[model samples]
Target chain A: MLILNVILVIFLIICAVAVERTKDLLGAVIIFAAYSLIMAVLWLMLQAPDIALTEAAIGAGVTTILFIGVISRTRRMEK
Target chain B: MDDIIVKTITRLIVPFIQVYGIFVILHGHISPGGGFSGGAVLGSSMILFTLSFGLPMASRKIPHKVTSILETSGILWYIIIGLAGIYLGGKFLVNKEAGFFMGQAGELISAGIIPLLTLGIGIKVASTMITLFHTIIEED
Candidate 1:
């Protein structure tokens, strides 16, 4: 259990850093969605299933689409 | 957006997503998910449809006027429910004292006024999400 938690946390950090570093806005949004999914799992492990559900829906699902829409309207690459 | 694979998959999956969202909203009082989360899920399904099939079709499925009406009605329903409590000689948003039916614990219909409140919130949230997404996408 501890090992799994550590792995997830590590992935979370990597995803966060990657999202910031990526020049492609689309890639960043996808990475952020991944981060949201990981956070949702962590929330579930921490016994906050309600928050997990909300995070998964709003973070991974709706936020990703909204970001994609914004990226479509604006520039795909950050520059 | 014109990919046949994506369209086929979306068509196959959207109904299930909507059903799951409704399940979450209806079981909210007894489950971990509530109105807001479930509504997001529901709204996202519509978004998925919009992504796969053009926005025009999606807008036809749920027009702006319809969303406006739904948004207004959702809040109105919540207010009406709250007023019922006051009419019953109880404080605002009162539950059991407001004469609401509280079935057995763990049952679907239990939790006086909570499920109704969740329904109202679910409708409001889902419509709001759709409206926001449509506005942003249609802006330019």
Candidate 2:
């Protein structure tokens, strides 16, 4: 479990950097959603089911929708 | 999307998603979930519908005026429940001692006022999500 936690944490860091370094807005938004999903999974592994559920729903779910809407309404590629 | 597969799958699975959301809200007091999480699940389904079908179709199901009313009503409902406790000679939001039906624990209708509060919160949260999405997507 500790190894799994370490792996997830490392993956989360990678996701965070990838989200930042990406030039495409849509790609960044998608990576952010993946980051939210991974954080939710981490919460589940920590035995915080309630928080895990909230994070998955709000972070990965509605926030993703909002980001998609923003991306569609505005420019998709960053200069 | 114009894609046939996305539309068909969204139509097929939306009902099941809603049912699951309702279950989560209803079973909140007896299980690990509560108003926030359950409401998020319900909100996400509506959001999913909007994603697949577009905002106009989704607006008919939950319009702007109705969403606003429901959101305010949810908060009002919560306060009203708390006031009931005060009216019954207890502190605000008091449960079980305010003459509420305290059925056997771990049952559906057991917790006094908790389920009611959860219902209010669920409605509020769901409507808020829809409203926020609509606001962002609506053209000026």
Candidate 3:
């Protein structure tokens, strides 16, 4: 389990880099949402349900909503 | 550097990452992972999405004020819970004496209001992360 966890962490780290490399801001947001979801799962596996739920709702849900709103405001500004 | 590898890698690893994040959050009471760690993961995930999809795409689904509210509300929830514990005739965050939980270390109800506190913390951290992501992604 420890080894698996390590591998997962490494994977997350790499994905994080992917988020930085992507040019499409929307794609980046999706990846970031994925990142938050994964983190929530990790938290659950680690035994923090409260945290996990918060991550899912606030991190993945509410925050995402906010990002989308901002995106709509500035869609024309993108290259 | 390439889209294919990055996309494939994201597709493969993202699930595991999210699962692990939940694991950590749940295991916080039993181990090192907790609300803070889980929240950080959420923030980073959104950040990644922003980087790959562009800030507009990510922001299109949500707005900055919502995140700000989440952050502040989470904090208020935490303080309210703690104060509730105090109002109930125990010290701030008083667990065993407060009668909010069973008082057993491993028991779900044992931590009294700690879990609630953690929930608030997780929200706060995650929302804050989103706020930061908005700032970075919006920048030209």
Q: Which pairs clash in the backbone of model 2?
A: none
Best by DockQ, which number?
Answer: 2
What local distance difference test score does each model get?
0.92, 0.91, 0.73
Candidate 2 ranges beyond 4 A from true positions: none
Candidate structures ordered by TM-score, highest first: 1, 2, 3
TM-score of chain B of each: 0.96, 0.96, 0.83
Model 3 ranges off by over 4 Å: A1-79, B1-4, B107-109
What tens-digit string does per-residue lDDT give for candidate 1 at A1-79? 9999999999999999999899999999999999999999999999999899999999998889888988898889899
Residues A1-79, candidate 3, lDDT per residue (tens digit)? 8887887787778769988988777887888888888888888889877677667766776567667757766772336
Model 3 chain A lowest lDDT segment of ten: A69-78
| Candidate 1 ranges beyond 4 A from true positions | none
Give the DockQ (2 decimals) of all models: 0.81, 0.85, 0.06
Candidate 3's residue-wise lDDT over B1-140, tens digit each? Answer: 33776657666675676676666556667566578877777666666666565667677855788889999999999889888879885688666666675566876545667777777887788779778758744655
Better of 1 and 2 by DockQ: 2
Candidate 1 per-residue C-alpha lDDT over B8-41 given as tens digits, one digit per residue, 9 for 90 to 100: 9999999999999999999998989999989998
lDDT of 2 by residue, A1-79 (tens): 8999999999999999999999999999999999999999999999999899999999998998898888898899999
